[model samples]
Target: MSLLFKELDYRPTPIGVLSLRRRRELSLDIDVYEIKLDDEYLMSSLFTDAEIALADLGLADLAGDSLDVVVGGLGLGYTAKAALDNPKTGKLTVLDTLPEVIEWHQQGLLPLGEQLSGDRRCELVHADFFGASLSDIAGMNPQRPDTRHDAILLDVDHSPGNVLHDDHKRLYTKDGLQKLATHLVPGGVFALWSTELPEPWFEENLAAAFDDIRAEVITFRHPLIDREDINTVYIARKAS
Candidate 1:
């Protein structure tokens, strides 16, 4: 079998608690790491299917609506790239908490980063999405008027039920969900990528925040290998 990219060990300075590795495929670079505490295979570049699903399914109907999009995680830049592919997207904002992740992308570890960064429509912010203030986003491009986003796609951590940080659990709570809902313009959409099926309670919580909600299982064939895998995509639309 042919390999996409070669894997190289990566260790970020100062954040010595965790170990990360990167591999370069024919066109894309993948990062694999063991996050501290949980010790789970915290993240990988293998599941870009989930990322694209978040972008494609979430913004499918809003094709030419002059939309602003906010993506919570910048993993591999797949979601951001997919979102930018839509002509309907007027502005694209991506938020990530890890400076290392951003730096890696900026330095060309992720092949798509340079193109996305160079795009006049895309903005990359290094901050925790949950803590980002509305004013901060509005300030990104002062020339453009402040407008609530048409879609928000979040893939910060794992599914709500399988979160790596205890604090992230609040993002799934009623209050947290309400905060997310408030950021959306009327009739806007919110999409989340889940590594597994979300908990029943979490699905109910999503229903409470939006008037319409839909969940689908997306199957993808591995880019290099023929193996098939599935991930969950949750899409909700704000009430008009």
Candidate 2:
């Protein structure tokens, strides 16, 4: 089979230069859609295990029906789509700082964009998630105020310590995390997907803000690298 490669879209945004590229992986023998923020790779359709897992494992502890959720980042729509797959999910609102990224999905630029946009349960908002905390939770819900969700899934930065933007650093702190919990219900869950391994210090920060804080190391085989790889997803519950 012939290799395929192309830069589908590229534009300047407040964060940096956002790009959408498609490349065929010879080993996998399939096309892979990838998104990039400046020089850093943001997401790829090829390895969506961790992204989808972010929704599945994060919301695993949730109970009852009519669930409301807020996904902090909308990379390639994998996590959003996964959340919508849950039958109990009543509404899934996605918040992103980049307007262009949201536009890409609305315009059917990304692979799962059309499906996610067409779903009544999924709503993409153009706003800075990191900036939204207890001090200033305005504009987070867009249509309503003081809208708390059952689960808040995050996958914006690399990790609690490794952030793509400097502004994101505060979101990992105890104070920032405490503020984040204000957007959730008393028993709501905060799930964070990180590229770094499980860090005890980070868990300590989470413990200070919430209860039942735990980190799970997700291991999977990388077809591209032909080796085993690992990532972490931090799960915590707000005070009940």
Candidate 3:
């Protein structure tokens, strides 16, 4: 391997061939970490504003201490790190479908891996976030399956309509949204990160299960293209 690029780890996942790579950006003189599923790029360390905002905006809505938060994806650990950064967060549970991803953090492969794994308040679990959200008895936290959380932040699918798996589509519906709320406490928040703008139909379904719904458009500089890119964060609160 050249000094410019290196493959940190590669594994076969149920979804696809998952790979973690680190490459040096000659133009910027910095190392860039990227995750890919098959040939498609899943996430990159260079672009993380929206991931962090998902935690910041969700936690900002509630006024309390010792907040128990759940992050639906563990990609690069940016969102998980942000949740732990908040002083109010007492426990942060991160769920990812692929166990390899969780192990990467535990073994310290990603940049934020050591910080996330070493944090006393953070717990990384291997599970299906979508399934847990819809489970009648089990909540997002595996250790305390019956306990409800203060906030659930999701960054899994590309958008409400563009899910990575077919089963995830149900969670975007009105009925599924209602079930997801059952795992949350009254006044708890559900924040979703979408690659595109919010859809009207999704908002209608979100309204059925949540209150004070807001779609936040977050913009950041695209390092590869040198242009502004946008990601939407939908924040909704359960009825208190």
Off by over 4 Å in 1: 1-20, 24-40, 63-65, 133-146, 222-227
Ten-residue stretch with the least lDDT total in model 1 = 30-39
By lDDT, the best candidate is 3
Clashing residue pairs in candidate 1 are: 4-25, 4-26, 5-24, 5-25, 6-23, 6-24
- lDDT score of model 1? 0.73
- Root-mean-square deviation of candidate 1: 4.4
Ranking by TM-score: 3, 2, 1
Q: Which pairs clash inside model 2? A: none
Each prediction's whole-model lDDT (CA): 0.73, 0.86, 0.92
> Order of all candidates by lDDT, from best down to worst?
3, 2, 1
Cα lDDT of model 1 by residue, 45-83, tens digit: 666778887899999977565688989877678899989
Q: Write the per-residue lDDT of candidate 2 for residues 1-240, one digit (tens) a residue.
A: 534898889998877898998888887788888899899888888778888889988898999678889999999999999999988789888999888889889999787899999998889998778877545653357666567889999999888888988888887888888888888888999999999898888899999999888888888888777799888888999989
RMSD of 2: 1.6
TM-score of each candidate structure, all chains considered together: 0.81, 0.95, 0.97
lDDT of 3 by residue, 110-196 (tens): 879999999999999988898898888747887898899999999999999998889999999999999999999999999999999
